[model samples]
Target: MPFIKLEGGKIDKEKKERLISEFTRIASETLGIPEEAFVVLIKENEMDNWGTGGKVLSKILAERGNK
Candidate 1:
């Protein structure tokens, strides 16, 4: 069994579904694990809880006018 843990902020349902499908497919094929045996866990946090370059994601996105 394979366990995949991801910490990506604020993903929509469609993208999350696609990611799970694609990741399962590739992992199953490459690792020779059954699709049903693979586990994928995604933990989403607010942008404020994630940071880069000493700046929180929310602040960075705000400065970039993205959020």
Candidate 2:
């Protein structure tokens, strides 16, 4: 089985579905593997749990006036 893992901030269910479908479709075509043989896992983390440039992602978004 081909494993696909994605880790990031929260997203709506629809986006997750689309991501899984699209990822599997693309991978299947590129690798010549069946979609059913792929396993896709999406991990959603709180923005505060993510960090970049020595700053929490949540704080960075807040500073930029973003949600």
Candidate 3:
């Protein structure tokens, strides 16, 4: 069995469904493994809970003027 973990900001239901489908397809094709044999875990975090280079996501986005 193979496990894939994806973690990042929250995503809408539609995007989540698409991601799952894409992941399954790629895993099955590249690894020659059945979709049922693979496990995928997605974790969503708030801006304050996620950081890069010691700066929170909100701050980063603010710096980029996307906030």
Candidate 4:
């Protein structure tokens, strides 16, 4: 089985479903693997727990006036 792992900030259930379906569809077409043979894993983290450029994600988003 093929595994797809996505790590990012939290998202709504609808978005997660979309991500899984889209990923499965595209990967299945490209790799010639059945969608049922693939696994999609979404790992969500709190904004304060992840960071870039040494700054917490929550702070970065705050700076950008996004949440």
Candidate 5:
């Protein structure tokens, strides 16, 4: 079984579905794994709970000029 975990990001339901579809396609084409054998887990966190360089994620994104 192949397990794919996607964490530390905010994603909508539509995007999540698209990710799953892409993963399945890649696994089947590149890894030769059946879609049924692949498992994907997505975890989302608030900006306050994730950070880098002593700055909160919201702050980091702001500093990088990404809204």
Candidate 6:
């Protein structure tokens, strides 16, 4: 059995769903385990609480036109 924990800033429901599905597919194939034997956890944080290169994720996304 495998437990997957994904940590990131806020994201839409559609993207989250896709991520979970993709992760399950890859993990199941790579580990040769059934998809039902895996557990996936998505942990979201506030923009201010997540950062990269000394800058907050919100600011980076805003500067990039919110992607």
Model number with the top TM-score = 2
TM-score, candidate 2, is: 0.96
The models' CA-based lDDT, in order, is 0.91, 0.98, 0.87, 0.96, 0.87, 0.91
Candidate 2 residue lDDT tens string, 1-67: 9999999989999999999999999999999999999999999999999899999999999999999
Candidate 5 residue-wise lDDT, 10-67, digit = tens = 8989999999899888988898878999988888888888877888988898888985
RMSD of 4: 0.9
Error of 3 at 67 (Å): 3.5
What TM-score, over all chains together, does every model reach?
0.88, 0.96, 0.87, 0.92, 0.84, 0.75
Candidate with top lDDT is 2
Candidate rank order under TM-score: 2, 4, 1, 3, 5, 6
In Å, residue 53's CA in model 4 sits off its true spot by 2.3
Q: Ten consecutive residues with minimal summed lDDT in candidate 5?
A: 44-53
Whichever of 3 and 6 has more TM-score, that candidate is: 3
Instruction: Choose 3 or 5, whichever is better by TM-score.
Output: 3
Write one digit per residue (lDDT tens) for candidate 6, span 5-52.
Answer: 899878799999999999999999999999999899999999888788
lDDT for each residue of candidate 3 in 1-67, tens digit (9 for 90 to 100): 8888889888998998888888988989999989999887789988889788999998999899985
Candidate 6, residue 66: CA error in Å?
5.2
| Weakest 10 consecutive residues of candidate 2 by summed lDDT | 3-12
Off by over 4 Å in 2: none
Name the 10 consecutive residues with the lowest summed lDDT in model 4: 43-52
What is the alpha-carbon lDDT for the whole of candidate 6? 0.91
Candidate 1 off by > 4 Å: none
Q: Cα RMSD (Å) between model 3 and the true structure?
A: 1.2
Mind giving the per-residue lDDT tens digits that candidate 1 earns over 1-67? 6898888888999989988999899999998889999898878999999899999999999999998
